[model samples]
Target: MAELYSRRSFLAGALTAGMLSTSAGYFFTRRNKIQLTLATGADPTGGRQLLVSMWNRLNPNVQIQVREVNSSTQDQFLKFNETHADIFNLDVIHIPRFAAEGKIVPIELENDISLVAPVRRVCERTGTDQLWAVPFNSDVGMMFRRVTDKRADAPVTLKSVLAASATGPVTFAGQLDTVGRQTDEAFVCNVLEHALAQDEAILDEGGVLSYGLGQWRDALAPLADAIRRKRVVAAAGEDDTARAFQRDSLRYMRNWPVRYLPLDRAERARPDTAEIRIDRLPLGILGGQSLAVAADSDYRDEAVRAIHFLTDNPAQKLLTSFGFAPTSVDAYIDADLQEALPHLSLVRYAVEGSRPRPIHANYAEFARRFADHTRRHLHDGEELTQQFITDIRSVLR
Candidate 1:
């Protein structure tokens, strides 16, 4: 039966001689368990813990294993393409890059596990939405505050944040992580640029790309100035954003809901220090992760079932319970969760209204240049305001 199935897959893909031998041993057996390897930058053991519990309850026979992938570097999980995995949990920004490379299979969404609009963009961007992966979680950006600094009346907009954080450091990720490619950085950079553009602070309607480029530079100007002025310092990824604020260095921080779940878990696990505070990615744009299935997986039937059970309301609620926002439009409106997680409203608003970075295939190339420009202008005083415009034009062209 294994040989027969292998032959079918080979015929479907027209596997070369070497590839044929590679997949020869691929099939389910009583002794071997079906494996689903998911890649994520932030270790989602808490979320996985809940899913595993539910998965065990639903199907005791099929086994699912979650591998903590350092997506920033792409060293650990990149090989999954050579030997297909059942499912992939991918960073939204990385989707376009992955899709462009044809490394992923198209998703045929099954059951109640419908793909969210934002996540659908991943498929749309990759042109593999219907074929590869089902949208898993719709993560959005959230603003983190120190437990003691929470004033009943706090600033929520970027403009106000700048004013209040003028004298202190506002936090954000400095170094790109495993998944921190150009696309990922663009999500953060573009969000700020989008807001600044709307305020007439950056970008113009000519669509010259120069105008947009100018806005991006201008948008980052204040934040860069803030950092130079000792008002903003790069926080340690999303995980440290919350704690960095607690240390009195960061008065304001922007991060994803997933990064802070561990902080929340720590709060529950040990209530010693202080309660972490969260809000949306500051009335700007946000990004998230989605789930996709291997186009070549034999367990498509079971894979679809697992996806459905993992993304619905019950699963989303479980996510919310762990301090991560749900992608479901309903979860965005859930008053209880909103009250529990102050950032929930922000995430919902961002998701409904947030814009992703340029969906072009060249985004990865663009991101590399953008980050270099940011470092040069923000760190090295390389006159990025004008040079940025020229460089982006060079890349876009």
Candidate 2:
């Protein structure tokens, strides 16, 4: 057996070699007891634990060993390389890179999986025309406001949000404070959402990089004006905005559904607190995780079975109980789940309309460069000068 390297080292080698070896053989012996190792990020909501329990109940002969990995995708990949875990859970955006590197094996479905069309699309590897991962939970950005607000209608667009804010009926907050290339991922996500709302494309169908320079300017101009006028509260990240909203200092916020879980709990505990109302963003970025079987795993069969068990209708419903949006279309319409999660319809709308970030082997590099320039543009008060635009274009190329 060859030694596994860290994700960074493996990526470097893969880039140089143009491909990774996927010839590892799987050998399984029939036994009374079977064990599988699963590598995944730490779950605060205990959703993974519930899945493990369900799987164990269904297959008493098999036991799963869960190993918690880092939250960072790169760090999770590093753990995956070192452990060669039977099953690896990772972000949907990483599917392209991991599949290209041959770190994850393409999954063959014995029966059709009921994943929403958008979520299913993200799991497919364009280059190989294979399904690289099984969609577990899906997310998309949405606008949240207090239920007590007197607004006659929801802010359906960025222009509407700004207009509402200008009238003093509501104050808007978003993740806009960019520190450096190290700017918050939410900030970068927000920028992409803004651009996409205007029908912009960062990369075309052929995977060629292109900077929608004009679209960037058009999207940011109104947001900049709003920030200047102090109608939109510019916060560092989601937490900051959430805190402000909780204090009734801000009337509207753009954030992920996960943020709502806690706020909803707080509202239930204290009716005096801001009761939240959710609505889909006119456009937003999709965010979520998927499960993939490692190419080098010793328990490929067991791993695939585990992924299937996790994504099944019952398990997906359990996931929604943990505040995760389900990838299954049926889960969105389930009567019981709909009663528990009143925002299910709004979430379904957002997920259907949301777009995934650009998928490419070099996406990590592209995201870093995009964040760096957008941060400078938004925070440093740098005008989108011709030279600066050229620099942005150069980074994408």
Candidate 3:
């Protein structure tokens, strides 16, 4: 992760000015300047803003504006029903759904920097030979442990992980409340990871579920224990979970890359604690955002140009300087850029090996089913059935 102090120096001077050398042939003159909108979540690192500002200056005729996108994944999907903006920044998991619905159009997303394989895979529509989006950043789930813990690694089984923490089993406290009433992506990702671990073919590209009935009990035993024990911290969301993890006397946390900053700081202030990362999990879930052109937009070609600028080599490096994981494999090649992220090695491990959550047009619904069913079975002790797997296919539309 890029420390705040390091980010300031890394983005200090030439980083903003270096783009003045972009080819003039690709941009129109200032007199022909036109505006385009980019919808993306707000980044605390301010890297997103920097990339846009740089693009505007170099390609004055193709000036871009940033629109603060909705934080809710469902809300973002709804906005995609029509051309909400010229450029849509989508969570990688949503790409398949949005592309299938024609909310985002297919474009041969070319990149000057070769993106990581896992990152590249999410940009594509499942079961198709077409690319629908360009990866903007990369994320992967990891198990964090306190250095004081006797277990040097993540516990072998789900049960062992629950008891690893000193303060009850709040270890997996992130989104524990998503049990009964579903719709939480974190909870869904957790269930999907375990299922994938059991059998890679459990879910097909069309969103069909086909694992053994016993797989449900085996896959969600930990969730059941968490509910019965009521040991999970009641975190409202991801940010709240991070804060709660910092405050709780817990030994393990499952979260994304950006967590290193806050966790590291918390450990620094605590006299008896230090954090270490267990990046190599049995399987890690892919998490990140991608850029796509809106299907209804009149400026499809122009939007594609904006996508190129935002994901170009320099912009990716600038995002790296601000602590965002680079989707581009080339970002790691720069020695200075590597220094900005102290946890680059682990980040590499997680990103390269991470697997996407089940791909479906109605992916959010698919996520809800897994989250809802897991909670249902745990609450009522309902065993998985062949009908249950059959019903999972209903989410295809």
Compare the candidates by TM-score and give the number of the best one.
3
Model 1 lDDT vs. the true structure? 0.53
lDDT of 3 by residue, 208-278 (tens): 45656776556666556665666656454567667676677666666777666546755756766645544
Off by over 4 Å in 2: 1-32, 73-83, 127-129, 149-156, 166-170, 178-183, 198-210, 228-230, 268-274, 385-397
lDDT of 1 at 162: 58
Where's the lowest-lDDT run of ten residues in candidate 3? Answer: 174-183
How high is each candidate's TM-score?
A: 0.72, 0.82, 0.84
Backbone clash pairs in model 2 (N, Cα, C under 3 Å; residues 3+ apart or in different chains), count: 0
TM-score pick, better of 1 and 2:
2
Model 2: per-residue lDDT, tens digit, 213-300?
6766776776666676677767777777787776764567888887777676576455543366778887668888888998888778
lDDT of candidate model 2 versus the reference: 0.69
> lDDT rank, highest first?
2, 3, 1
TM-score rank, highest first?
Answer: 3, 2, 1
Q: Judging by lDDT against the true structure, name the best candidate.
A: 2
Report residue 147 deviation for candidate 3 (angstroms): 3.0
